[model samples]
Target: MWLLKKLSPDFKTIADFRKDNRGAIKRVCREFVLLCKKRDLFGGELVGIDGSKFKAVNSKKKNFNEAKLLCDIYSVLFLMI
Candidate 1:
C-alpha cells in the first residue's frame, strides 16, 4: 500500500507494464491454474462465461415496450404479406 502510494503510476505506466510483461503474466496465470487443478479446486460440472455486449441506447427512438414489439412484429408480417 505504501509502495503503491509512493510510486502511484498513471494509467500509461500501468498499461506499459502490462504490455511489456504480458508473457510473464500469462505464464504466472497458467502456473496458478495448474496448481489449482492439481488441488482439484475447480468444479468441472458447470462453467458460465458471459461475453454478451450490448449497445448503449438512451434515445426515445430506440426504446421499446411490449406494445411496441408487437406493433413492429405486425408491421414486419404485414410487409411480408
Candidate 2:
C-alpha cells in the first residue's frame, strides 16, 4: 500500500509502461510458466468453473426461447427464398 502510494503513476504512465514492456513481459511470463511446469506445479486437469449467478434483467417480453429463435430463422429464410 505504501509502495503504491509512493509510486502512484497516472493512467497514461501505466499504459505507456505496459505498451513499452509488452514483449519483455510476455517473455518473462512464458519463462515463469515453463519453470512452473518443470516443477510440476500445475494440476493434470485444470477445471475453470465460474460460479457467478447474474440476475436476468430482461422480462418475458424481451426474452426469446428456442422456438422463437427457430421461427425467426425460418421466417428470414422464407423471405430470402
lDDT of each: 0.93, 0.91
Top model number, TM-score: 1
Error of 2 at 69 (Å): 32
70: Cα error in model 1, Å: 30
Q: Write the per-residue lDDT of candidate 2 for residues 1-81, one digit (tens) a residue.
A: 696887777999999999999999999999999999999998878777899887877787778999989988999999999
Q: Please, what are the lDDT tens digits per residue for candidate 1 over residues 1-81?
A: 686787677999999999999999999999999999999999877877799888989787999999999999999999999
- Provide TM-scores for the models: 0.53, 0.49
Among these predictions, the greatest lDDT belongs to 1
* Per-structure clash totals for the candidates: 0, 0
CA lDDT of 70 in candidate 2?
Answer: 100
Model 1 misplaced regions, further than 4 Å: 5-7, 53-81
Number of clashes found in candidate 1: 0
